[model samples]
Target: MTTIPMYDPLSPEMISDPYPAYARMLEERPIHWHPVMRAWVVVRHADCVRVLREHATFARDPGRTGEEIPDFRQNVQMMDPPEQTPLRQLLVGAMRSQDKDQLFQEAVAFLRGRLTAQEPGEPFDWMATLAAPFALHMSAALLGVPEPDDEAYAEISHGIALRMDAGLAPENIPQGDAARKRLNELGESWFPRPEGDDGLIANLIRRADKEFAGSHYIRNSAAMMFNASYGTIFAMVGNAAHLLATVPGLLPELSVPSHVATGVDELIRYDGPAQGTSRTAVTETEIQGTRIAAGDSVVTLLAAANRDPLVFKDPQDIKLDRRPNPHLGFGSGPHACFGSEFGKLSITAMIHALRDEGLRPCLAAEPTRRTTATVRSLDVLPVRLSR
Candidate 1:
């Protein structure tokens, strides 16, 4: 067996840019046990697909691996079917009730207002002013809840993101704990809500059956949906904006209405918000000739899988119209992202608004990235918009 290189997710370099390290791992150890993470790392596209799709062999809940997980982590994404199926259906049904065109128009108006507020020649922080607020607005619309204060939302979301890394970085536990507490409090306020309400939370509360009657189940699930919706769009738009500002030849392609949807998929495949997610082996499984015993932890490097050259030709380059794109940006199988359509609509709205306004963004200053491992986010993105 070839020796696996040390993989430290918290390393500053990895936090800033992990694709290089992921490439090396994919080239050498497609699937191997990592002593530090105490899990098998699966990097190749085919292998990662196998791990995500085969729910019978690989379970979403870490508890199956004999590791005790906090209750907050037990949202629908962490469950396996038959338990996962009905909850997913409920969430999906609630989401379908959202007005896609109306939401898109709302997003466009919101972005236009933000863009117009900034002077043409002056640089403004895109992430703080535009990306985050746009995401928050869309999230509130989807949940049928009033928009929360941006500062408070930022603090809570940051803590939750940090909490995700608590397993790998022990120092984040306290912040994660605080975030969890705040989230629980927030979830509580939404309850005793009328089932006749139009928001996604109300829909879930109304449709919840005896199995999901537990207070924690609905609350945590709603919170999960809100957070995931906010964070994904925030990161995605920021990443896309950065590319549109810096990458050559992208602006023209994406400006076309027909290409906007295709471009969104390309952006997700290129540098999606989620870096990776873990699954536990319920039964002994072999991936690419490597044997994984039951109860072993397996981490699928999703960002790496999306860029695997064997599946995506010219994987490093951005092809806005790339076809047969089977990217795992939203994952796959039983646990695929529940808000993918909504996410796509929100992202497409931003791009289309920019196109209509003839707004071309250029980087004003060097952008900084967040240090979190699980959610790849931008700390600050400064841009100067020109019409």
Candidate 2:
């Protein structure tokens, strides 16, 4: 057996750039048992794709096959095929209802407002000022959070994120607990909205059967909305902006819609915000002859899979024009990021906004990153708007 290399996804060095290590792992032990994370980290693109698509053997929540987790069952992402199929179909219908052109226009309108108001020579944090608000507004609309209650929406989102992502510190768990309570209460109000309503909250209400007649599904589903949709978008757009700003001569390509779309895909493919996710083996399984016993956890390193040399040509290089790009940035299979369309549109709008007037780093404060293991996010990014 080849000696599997050790790489801690939580370490600060990994936070800066986990790709080089991931590359090594993919080449040496694509199915290496990572001691630090205590799971077999699948680094190859083919293997990750299979793990995601093969929902039968690899269950999202191992508890589902054994003991039931009430909250986990409600989360569509944490569900398996036979159970999640119907619910996911319903969500697909709702997602299709959204007008992509309208979304693009809305994104442009919102981002242009922020960019126009920026101080020419000074640095401004893009995440708080633009990315957060843009994502918050869009998520609010999707979750059916009514206008004029920004505080409630914010609190609910923060609490949901803390609970789902384990972002809350031990001492801060109380705040998250309180926030979840608030979200449950808010669900009550949202669940009673008219049947004709289009927000995700209302949509979930309409789909609820006797078993799910209330906000039980709504509250948990909202977490999925935040994580896969709004939160992912917020992180990716911000990260993409920071990366794009550093690239020279790409501003012109942003003006073209085809290029913008492909650019967003490549940007996400190269350095997407999603760090990695884990799944549990339902029964015994083997990959490349490596045995994975039932109940063992397997972590899929998405960023690593996105850069597998076997799948991508010149894997290290970021080519916006890269075609046949089947990167697992949005993931794959049943639990793939369904909200990817909206995210792509949002990124395209960002590109166009920057194209109007080029952007440069402010040098006022260096960009900083959060110390998170499951996701990569920026703490602050300062950029100067240039015309």
Candidate 3:
């Protein structure tokens, strides 16, 4: 009998910096079942990619198998191919012809105005004031939420993010429940008749009315959209800013507006906000000669896979001009992130505005990191800016 290597997913060290554990897995036990988490961790670049792409072998839809994660019901990310097809098409088409250039310009203008209005010396939570708000507004505008003011959107968005980070803990369950209730209420109130339908929520409602007239479907779908747009976008902005501060000379390269757009990919690859994603195997399978049984959960470490030496030479270094950069930052396969372009555009806009405003960095403070079973992001980033 072959001795299977052991790994603990809930270990403190693994949570803080999972790369070491990932490396160990890649080297010795790339497909071992983790007894603690009751999941098989797929760590190598090749295996991760294969698992993501091959939906037949590794299932995304937990519902199909009567599997349920209390927090992730009705999420598009949890849906399999055929069921996900129509919804994915709707979202893709909504943002496909979007004028990214114009959007980026507007984002830059907005950021410039906000940063310029702030006093140079006084400390402000950059994540709260700048990155988080900017991401929320962008998502709100794109999703067609009633963006009355920056603060209003930020408050709702932040509340939702905090609720998600808390992850169904006894103390946090109320917040998540409250957020869902509030979002549903907002959706019902605003999308009553769809007179001024512009955002994604309105579009989804319209589609549902025209095609599938069901209250539960529309409400759950809208809630899922909110989770994706608000949470992921916030992470992208915060993570990019944090990376720019830590990586030497990366900011200067990003100063060029074109490079800002191009470099967003590199930033995501280097330190993507999404640390890992979970899937469950439906049948017995052998991945890289390691057998995994049916009904076992699998956590694919995308961040670690992105840094695999076999796939990317000098994997840790940031190369802004890396061509053919097929990083798993946006994930892969049927459930690949639909909002990837929107996220890239938002980050590009912020970087370009910072450069165009001739902003100089005054001080770099350590970023507060938010860790979870899935997403990774900065809780706060402190930066003094000079114009």
Candidate 4:
């Protein structure tokens, strides 16, 4: 085995196409100390799963071990087991147990509405034309945000993502901060007096005191939830579209609901929103013979973990219905995405809507990827819808 050269995620080459680097790392050193990132990089599927599953050993907040991972900055992502448990349970439990299929149909309807708005034979950037709007609206609906304010919230989410996805650029810090403040304010104002159908906001208000400190904490948690799925879902929609357009026969196979459901997992497994995540080692630990000191920052390489050949057969190739797929694209354990199922439903809906509309979208030009260390999203996708 050859030694893989140390590479930074912020580098230009990695930013444009990171799989090669990720592949190299998987072969040479699955787990090692990242000098640039100042974290222990875990790339293998099993190791990453261990890191995510053993919550107490590798704490998200690391407060128990004297590591000060702030909650205001990361919200639930920054919390540990006992603290994170109730909050996670509340959100997950709020789902309508019996109306899941009904929810799915509603989601499909919402996506079709957006996909049909595009004119055939005309070129449009998929990112802006459909992906962003659809994801943002769904996110707003999940948060129980009202109509007029949802649009404004989307803009705020965009600013926050610009600041977050790109490592919080120097010029973007203020905008991100202001967006946070406004979102917190919006959450506080809207949650106490939710109108129409009850959703995330109402649920948060109902359970805030039990899971969180107070209304102020609820406001902050809402801010993190607001920024979490909104933009990432936008990126995933475009990603799946790109794959469907580029990969032959995928468009047809993925059109089927069962296939679409499975294909959504493959799409996310192939190029999911989260490339990697940072966690602090709560205690002295050893992963595959490598010793990790307490307080070390562990960067779980989710992107690399998904492609580990040891776990999945033909990991590189995109097979629509790859079953037994345990990709860490959505993180794992306590820190897994709160709305993971909803994301899959939304993307599947996007595919069905596009296929149903006879909208065969093709990439007109080379799409641009988001230039960020953390965010792996297409900046723009120039697509032409056709017969």
- Choose the strongest candidate by TM-score: 1
The Cα error of candidate 3 at residue 334, in Å, is: 1.1
Q: What is the C-alpha lDDT of each candidate?
A: 0.84, 0.72, 0.69, 0.75
lDDT tens readout by residue for model 2, 61-164: 55656856645335567678787777677666666666677667777788788888888877789777787788877666655666426556655555544554
Clashing pairs in 2: none
Positional deviation of residue 44's Cα in model 3 after best superposition, in angstroms:
1.4
Q: Candidate 4, after superposition: displacement of residue 203 in Å? A: 3.3
Error of 3 at 232 (Å): 1.8
Error of 2 at 110 (Å): 0.7
Better of 1 and 2 by lDDT: 1
Error of 3 at 55 (Å): 1.5
Error of 1 at 384 (Å): 1.0
Models 1 onward score TM values of 0.94, 0.88, 0.86, 0.90
In order of TM-score, best first, we have 1, 4, 2, 3
lDDT, model 3, position 116: 90
lDDT of 1 by residue, 193-225 (tens): 675687777777677785675557677778788
After TM-score superposition, the amount by which residue 366's alpha carbon in candidate 4 deviates from its true location, in angstroms, is: 1.4
User: Which runs of model 2 end up more than 4 angstroms from their true locations?
Assistant: 1-5, 147-185, 194-196, 203-215, 357-364
